[model samples]
Target: MPTATADVLDELVRASALLTEANSVTRLIAAMVEQANDITRSDLAAFYLRTDHSEEVSFKLSYRRGRLDSPKELATNGELVEFLEESEESVVLLERKNSPFNELLLDSNSASGVALPLVTGRSLLGVLIVNSREERFYGRARLQFLDSLARIAAGVLNNAQLYRELQEHARQIEELQRYQENVFSSMTNLLVTTDESGRVHYFNRAAAERFALDEARVGLTLKDIFGKGLTKDVFKTIDTVEQNGQTVLGLEGIYKTDEIDIDYSLNIAPLQGKRGRHEGLTLIFTDQTAESRLKQEMKVVSEERRLIKDMFSSYLSEDIVKLLVENPDLVKPGGGARNATVFFADIAGYTNFSEGKDPASIVKILNEFFEEAEPIIRRHRGYLDKYIGDCIMAVFGVPVDAGEEDTVHAVTCALELQMLVNSPRRTFFRGEAEHLRIQIGMHTGPVVAGNLGGSRRMDFTEIGDTVNVAARLEGVAVAGEIIITENTRQHLGDRFSLEERKPVEVKGKKKPIKIFNVIGIDQQSA
Candidate 1:
């Protein structure tokens, strides 16, 4: 109706049209601030808007006269402090608000000021200030004029702010895409992502190049990879993870593609979905060169345990040694967690016999003893957990499924070890033939299990009352003996004649465990 309202209406019309065509919020805000300044007839004008990064608030200029300065990039902290405090005030005219903008306007330019806050629910989105050089610069005509302009401009600026934020988000996403492309394309390791149902979602460029894979074959199921027989380890790891919900990583295995040795180390992890759901799996597969160095290191580490297992098998059982080797991750030291069984064995007179033999011969004979004892252990399907000196400790149903024959297997291995020592192999171990004997003590019970180590060195081993009692029984056992515990006897369930031995206290065990002499099963009796 009035000139100011008419001019304000014109700016509102122009702001709306510019907003409609504006692809970005920055452009829209430029339109809003520019039109607001024009209609208010201000000599100088600036607008500051706020954004949140968590609880902390920072300011970006929504619009300013300097086109070269990105209004969005300028930090407006400590600049318009009091101006914001007075947004609800009917007016703040030509008075400093203890703000830098107020002081700067007074110092650098003789400008009278009119400032207002853009208030939304007690939060200041921004402030707009118009400055003119002439005194009594704003009348009721001018304040009404600026207020009219602020009203229309505020709504337009609100829309522009939304548009700008959305545009900035789109930009961030594009940059992230570029980053992903750069990383994925150049990675030396194979990278793959699969959907919730095991369907292929992404395979990096390295994976494609390493496999010489064609696009026609990229998005198929794991079955397709197996159909091509690209890798058995890949399919096996995938199947294991899918079936068990285990996140497995670092699987190193050789790939035989017509005798071209391809070694791969695979890392498999579950992909989490929105809301912490397991969506699928992602894999990073490293090829042979790095794998070889790692294998060398691992081989060195496992070498001692492997040797210990090899020698222990001579006196104990193959099943147990295999168990130790196959599931090293299963046996952790000092865990006190019960698994399934505990086993112990010792070479009778091993300590005394070693005194007479040369060091090399002792090593050789011990090795031979183990070689002689290997088969009977495997026949029983058990795991040899560890060996102490000539003593061999083994257990069934550990690190893997232990069949029902655990007791029979232990008995059978004992008999075989004795029988083997009696053979010509016994001739090579004349010391064993002359005096030394072997004893096995087995008890089925729980033992702690997990990876055990210090801040640095560690070993996977079982330490519990079960393990302690088993070792005690083995220590008291007479050589060439097959002694089992009451628990093992029960597990054996009369399949073997376990002649009751007196309850004996083993070291570290609070109470004595019932020990027995294990002999003839039903098959043995027949």
Candidate 2:
């Protein structure tokens, strides 16, 4: 062989080795095109791979020697890529002359060129091209050398393409797996997977905190996380799912720790393989401890509200119920010593009126009398504490602000009760109750007022010497008369017409208690 021919053959061997040894198609094509350009002594060389086998000729991979720019413009040369794909032959242009291929590379210094399709096993993979500034540089011998190089590289290029596609598919699968794992771990609900033998395999962050377990608990069994009792429930739920592919839902269980008890709703489903065979079990746990506690608290609060409404709805105004509801601390079981007025009202001659009356008749008469008097106590902002038979006990300045007018309200309530009793239209037992008279007594002093009773039953009332003095004053008052003590008289502040009675000795007192009969509201004050 001549020296030039020998060098060309050696270049062919090197090109063959480079194409076969390259792990990536890009590296192989780039090296191959560069070598082909040098061996042919051309100004430019490029490789264009056909992207799709369609009427629209499109090229995807384009690499040009020493030019980082894409060959998109050259590839769009519909006439050129079509000539290579359809003809499956080489095109040789010996002079810078008029041709559709030459017009495509108007900016090239090329005067002559050769284009050969890189075909293997009847598949046209791409086209290789060489351009030279000198005319007729690629004669019969050089063209033959280029043809031999294309033949040597076709099969290797095809394999490298397949390998690259496989690599990209693997990378995509890996990215998809990472995305799925991130979504699973970020959830707040407890998630865990168990094997067929009930051994735990996976646990997320929320599962760790919920079960009070860590990564070390991964290999533990169901019995390990929850003791025998709860584990039995877990297994039973899982068995239900495994039997007929039925989902077990809303199975609530309690998991108690040293700090608090956790109530959780659970769901169990089968972990199935691609062929739909049951591989294991997937357990989903939703923490409902806070929600359950809130529901219980709401239930208690609702019950309390209903009870308060039922107890006071007959007499207390809606505004008072609303105030007590908003400020529950005011009625919660505790008492404070405060200056307040207590009122006691009783029916005169009750023992004689009840002698011949049946038990139901006596109760009916007492209810009628109290029904007429309770609203007057509420109107004066006095809480009607209790009804002792036909007697009414009311307290002012409790569970709310009664202001400085508490004493005035007490005496005013007494006067209103007497007026309601003396009204002619108000009849009981067919006018037999017409002769019934009311005795009213009120006193102001330090009294302890609060809810007093067991947890199940409670009464809001006052207890102190003040309550006793008021009750005693009611006993000494004659029919249709309202009497009050010295303490209450001071707080009246000229609001009522008072009759100073003789000093009277009373039980629970070291001295004679000064008393006054409240005739009526002063005309000026009224």
Candidate 3:
């Protein structure tokens, strides 16, 4: 053999050894590129692997060696990939000025090179390019030697791919097995599996603890484990499933321990052998004793609350009645200071409008107005404090913290009330209350809120400066206007469009409070 041919044979032996010992595909591909560069005497070598063979070919892996100025990342030549798809043979370029690979190799510092398509039978693996900075460096003889090397490398890579696929399948199986083990160990239900002869084959952790049995009972029969307590009915259900190969789902039973009698729901599934013969059965036991007792207790509570609601329905608003029923302590004698927002809404000029109306008609109109407005307040998490003649007082952030948006919700609720009164859909708007308008005012601060009255008859309400300020603000409002103190506006942020109004004197305050007239809600929240 000649000098070049002898060198190629030696490199092939080294390459074969590396492939046999290789554990990872990336490390193996790196070895092949390094070997190709050294044996072919090139300035740079790159292995470009085609991963997808769709309408658009994707070169997924590009490994390069022997160039100091090469790009940190790799780029592929679409034309060269197309060229390899058609040609079975290799291509050599003595000058790359007008070559198809000129653009891809522009930053590669190449003058002459050989491109060998690594293939197996008819399958295209990748392209191995060996390029040099010297012109006319690789001739026909070197190209042939590189082709032989390319053929050997491609075969090793194909086997490596098969090995990698096997590893992935093994990893997935291990993961599935681990996941099943974790799920079984974490289950709260008692699970037991037995062979056809009633010999215990498997008992999960819960089953072992519930039955007070240890590892020594693994091979014990059902009669040995449960003794005379393995009832005939339970055994019959298990036998029916094994004999007919049918499954029994959610069968309830009672198990007696020394301390208590536990109610259990069982699910039995038939197990099969290699030839589809009945082998055994799996019993899954779920304890339903606590759940059964809880349902009974809930029924009693529901009956009591129903009676409570019927008695209070005639006296209080629906939300307050429900809240007080569910949490009776909230309406007890005293209360602590709570951060809250108080909203006051009064029907403006209501006395003048009701002058000519009858007493019965006036009462009907007041009920109609409250019916339309109270739900809006409750929807925004405000508690209906009271209906003081023509005014409605609502408190937010009480009974519970309705969040920082309490003031914003109060403003939004006020805006919605005006919309409700002016709405074309209201029958009262076109009838007796036709030109009706409301003035709503809101303020957020600390207040003492709870039931307040003598033992004769207590009332759930708030009493503080916050309540006084909110009521005073309502008195200053004109018809069809929503006025809010500066304190409430500061908490409302930019959620509403506000028009600054003249300052007004409030009761029990030294300085006049500055207020804003809410023109309209913002488009985003509207």
Candidate 4:
């Protein structure tokens, strides 16, 4: 090889290495323009890089002796640009003429110039032009060196474009990761993500605050954070998910601490990778403490209502007891005049029968009698008002109205009580007490009835002349007798067989009250 040709090859080798090292398209294009000017000894050099549009190109022009101008765009259809696009060989302009190559020289008085296409394989990246003041400035060797330099520039430009696209992709991926982290941290429910080995890798802001965890808690096992008590249940759920590859939702449990117990519903799901493989587990905890406390309070209220119903059922009918329990305000402290039938039943000769008996024996006999008698009153829709020693005061149609039937039910209840005293089923009445009998008196009239008493205590009962008249009648009755006043008899409407008794003087009234003996319920009316 000639000395000049050897030097050119050596310079081309060095330029290729430097161009390959250039990381940006602008820097590589500027370096290539400089190298073209140096190797060809041209007065002016311009490099045109293909724009995104195939018909236009952006060009940077440099002069060997003057300042560099900023890049400008030009149409690809120009004579010189057309030659560069079609031909691999450099086009040499021997003299300054009215040619497209002369226009690119600008104000420079160029005599000759050369245009070479920067191409790799079959693809043209751009065109490189060099102009000189002297004629035949681009010799065979100079054109060869410029062509070699264009190939290196084309390869380097392609790599630079790829590098810029990769940088943009990396930036977008980083922004997406930041957005996902913000969404996770802003969640209200506690969230935790753990690796297959159960080591926590991600704990969101809510999980950190709720569990009192810090950054150091990351990489810790679930056992360390939840302690042994709760971790055992969590691990069991995780194991089940692992075996089945299915999500488990709403596993309820209590997280206990010294101060309080937190009720939560946990959801555990398998975290899947891109290829549908299980990578880890994600745990979400929803706090249910407030809801659980509300349910427990309602349960207690329901139990208390049941107790109230049971206690009230003993005195009132099932329907009335239900109404009173559901609407407690209905039984507020107040009284009103209501037409009611009051029945008073007293054990005859009770003081004489218990004169020599022990107190326990007397109580036992009274309890047995009242036990058999109270149900008969309740069965007739009569409210057992109170028990006074050996007497039972029952009322009908006060808190709940039964209309005229109230007097009939009261009279029927009194007859059942008298039969109970005389029946052979009274086994507790033994020896001398076998002949014990009961007398009942019923009166129907206007009476004050309601829950009556002071704030500290109260009882639902009736009070007035009607209740007093019934008690007075019971005082004058003999054993095995059922008595009723004329007021009660009028309401009975011939439902019971009655025998009129002589008028009885009552303590509370000046006039004597007419009373009757209840023989029995009329067979057909019963």
1 versus 2: better lDDT goes to: 2
Model 2 agreement with the true structure over 46-146: per-residue lDDT tens digits: 78776765666565547787332324444555687678767778888888887877733423666777888888777888888777777877787678778
Listed in order, each prediction's TM-score against the native is: 0.43, 0.49, 0.56, 0.46
Candidate 3 vs 4: which has more TM-score: 3
TM-score between model 1 and native: 0.43
Q: For residues 491-518, write the lDDT of model 1, one tens digit per residue.
A: 6655666678788877776787788887
CA displacement after TM-score superposition, residue 358 of candidate 3 (Å):
10
**Backbone clash total, candidate 4:** 0
All-Cα superposition RMSD per candidate: 22.3, 14.6, 9.3, 23.2
lDDT of each: 0.65, 0.78, 0.78, 0.78
Residues 60-87, candidate 4: write the lDDT tens digits.
3422322333236445666666666677
lDDT of 4 at 482: 82
Ten-residue stretch with the least lDDT total in model 4: 62-71
Model 2 misplaced stretches (Cα beyond 4 Å): 1-9, 20-26, 49-57, 66-72, 75-77, 96-109, 119-125, 151-164, 195-199, 219-229, 256-261, 293-526
Candidate 3 clashing pairs?
Answer: none
Cα displacement (Å) at residue 379, model 4: 71
The CA lDDT at 465 in model 2 is: 94
Worst lDDT run of 10 residues, candidate 2, spans: 66-75
